[model samples]
Target: MSNLSSIYIHVPFCTKICSYCDFCKVLYDEKWLRKYLTSLEKEINLRYKSNKIKTIYIGGGTPSCFDNAFFEQLLKIVATFNKGKDIEYTIEFNPEDINENKIKLLKKYGVNRISIGIQTFNKTLLAILNRNSDYEDIKKKIKLLKDNNINNINIDLMYAISNQCLSDLKDDLEKIISLDIRHISTYSLILEKGTVLYNKKMPLISEETDAKMYNTIVNFLKTHGFCHYEISNFAKKGYESKHNLTYWNNNEYYGFGPGASGYINNVRYTNTRNLNKYFNGNYFFDKEILTKKDVMNYEIILGLRKIKGINVKDFYAKYKVNIFDEYNIEPLIKDKSLIFEKDNIYINPDKLYIMNEILIKLI
Candidate 1:
């Protein structure tokens, strides 16, 4: 068995659902939350084995929506794992849910990182997207986090809304840079099926316009000392998210609770997305045991999502196979869609928009 060292817990309840979000979440209710926590504790205990966990990420449906008692109980359960050595612990919070009390509770529980959902600064656009926060609220929460000495803060931003002009995006970037946050994750709006935005036929920016906006954000962040570590994530010199890096690097991780997925020891598993099923102790999620070929293809697909792309040396060290020899990458290299240099391989700058196509060819 592979040594498992990373854990991800998903809390599937939110105070309000965003129109554009397709994540598994439900309208929050106190009674439902209490029952959910009870079930969550049982799930954790059921999955707990003597594995050395190096990182723990409490992602959500807005984990910060939980009250102090629930948060404390959840942390107490997680504390059963290793701590105080070199572990990185993170919790995702919605901007409106953050407060002085919550920040204090997080610090008490040894949470070293906070990922805040601040989709946009424009109040009008936020309303259009049905996101629940104003600029003032976001600012206050960010200041509170900083005042509480929460150093590693990750801010989430979005672009390509129906009426979002380039200037609006610039203003959002300005507000974000003004905070001097350690990390930022920016994503283009995707109208997933079943989302309110998709149902309403919200307009997405044209391909050219979206590309320009993306490139602009990248250049601006780089000029401000934030490294574009991944396609959607920018971080200062050493503030890269270790928990997320485990996923990008294809390392083993265990996921618990509802709607959480994990890749451990080359086997990919997903916990049940249905909250009721999980609460019923079904653990009815799917699993895909990856073969050697599956792993090699997945490494290429996932690694290309990073701005620095894949390190051929590290790939060979882990899999004992040269990546180029394992796949037909020559056509892409000749077409200027892929680049190989300094023992690393990455997608060409201009062709990053078509990375999926290039990866499809490789696979």
Candidate 2:
């Protein structure tokens, strides 16, 4: 087995499920959370041999929703993993659940980064999305985080909601940026199957409007010194998300808990999604032992998400094969959808909106 430099712990309990979330999660219950955490510990010990983790990301239905004691215990178990002196530990928080006590616990556990799920400050949109926070609550939480020295914060924003206008999106962005936070992740609303929104037949913004909003976000963030490092992520210089970069860069990582997925030694595996099955000791949702072709294709798909794109020399070195010959991407290159320069291959900026179509041609 290869060494894992990154680890992801999924805590699948939320106080309430958002309308658009299809992630594996359940409503908060003390008994269920205890059982899940016990199983999660076992899963971690079973899969990982070393604790030398450079980065640890605690994500979930809402990690901060857990009780302070439970959160402390989880962090103590995580401490068993190989965490270096410079480990970048992050925990995702919902504004409704974040408090002074929770913030202190995060600091005590060596958490250096925090991602707040402040999708929007608009009360109407918050209600529609089933989010349990208001602008005032979020502002107070931000102050708490800052007071506790948790300055490495990232805020999530969503656009393209039904009836959402460009002006509304601009207001949200301005509010988030005005917080002086170093990073932001903005996503266009997608009505994924199996989510509450989809089941309720909720409407979404028109494709044309969504595209315009996305372009507006890119331009606006860039003007404010936030670099569009990934498709949906923007960050101030030197503040890019290191944990997520591990995934986009195609590095080996370990994932533990329900519905968590990981890639190691060219094999990708997902843990069981069923909480009962997981607690009963049945894990490993689905696994794929990828071939060389599978790896190459994945490299292309994931790498293209980054604006910096794939390094041609590094790709060739990793596979001991020429990328040009393997994918036959010259047609895309000729059409200006793909560009090859400086030993790197990337999609053209203008074609990023149509990345799927371009990737289909390459694959």
Candidate 3:
């Protein structure tokens, strides 16, 4: 309702759940899919005020896993949006789920970006994560997407798995770089409470090793003509993910479907993770009506996730108060944990691994 320019739709159905995933998802069921699609449309109709959106990210438990019928229907529903001419429409895909038909359907619906969940190229690691994707198979899939003209692709690389070494990480990076994609999103494994890995008590690699891997990714990507645009994202020049930038920039966006979150009209809200609750017209689980101070806090926390950090002048203009006067960041800057250069403030690149501690000092 506040001139929102982005919308995120969550599809919570997967053919198989990964061992380390804790996202809201369930095994694919036709009846549930029908119901979910219906409920999603109703939620949008009830909540969305018909703003002309600039980006639509269809993220999921493998959004590309659906058959053409359901996928087309989903697209039709999304087509209701008043989209911009240059809108960035993205959908998440698993390598095994992508095919000619699905890629064609995506193109027909104006989806220009595809985010693939290829955690790693190591067969042993893939098995450990209960995911199935080999380099050869993924190469074929990427070729398929390109054959159809959807070239803005992002592949996810996950590191710090149990028993994963620096060599394994380097191998993964080499294969991913060879894929010639536009953007890459990297994630370090975190043991969530309800995931299969957590149930098995899977241990993560050492923190020191994890930090080394993070630095390796940053350095490797930067050396390969990829811009390290965010803490965990690398992109080719002019190919950054605008939908994700919406979150990092603390801009308002609509989040539809289960387990999604949105910010609008100074209120941050999350939809219920429970599908039954969502289907029963009980979409909202919780809402936080942010005060002016809370908004500023969010602006700092989210904006700093970008590698370039926040513009001090823009911050002052938005809040009508100087950030240096509000938070005593001088100590951090003095210690070199935070860097202030060219009217922008950011966490030191080397200390990005400990960004939380730096944030705690400021917030």
Query: Could you say which candidate leads in TM-score?
Result: 3
The residue-by-residue lDDT of candidate 2 on 279-344, one tens digit each, is: 998988899999999988988998999998999899998899899889878888898999988988
Q: What is the alpha-carbon lDDT of model 2 when measured against the actual structure?
A: 0.87
Comparison by lDDT, 2 against 3, better one: 3
lDDT of 3 by residue, 1-363 (tens): 554799999999999989999888999999999999999999999988889899999998778777889999999999999899999999999898889788778878899999999999999999999988889989999998898888999999999999999999999999999999999999999999989999999988999999999999999999999999899999999999999999998889999999999998999999999999999999999999999989899988998899899999999988898999988789999999899999999989989999999999899
Query: Among these predicted structures, which one has the highest lDDT?
Result: 3
Where does candidate 1 have its weakest 10-residue lDDT segment?
132-141
> How many residue pairs collide in each prediction?
0, 4, 0
> How well does candidate 2 score on lDDT at residue 182?
85
* Tens digits of per-residue lDDT for model 1, 1-363: 354778999888888888998887888888878877888778878776768777899988988888888878878888888653878899998887787778778888889899988889888998988886677777777788888888799999999887898999999999899888899999899999999989999888898888888988988999999998887899999999888888887778888888889887788988888877888998748999999989888888888888788998999998999888998988888988899889878999777777778888988
Once fitted onto the true fold, the runs of candidate 1 whose alpha carbons sit more than 4 angstroms away are: 1-3
Alpha carbon lDDT at 301, candidate 1: 85
Ranking by lDDT: 3, 2, 1
Any residue pairs clashing in model 2, and if so which? 51-81, 51-82, 52-82, 53-82
In model 3, how large is the Cα lDDT of residue 152?
Answer: 98
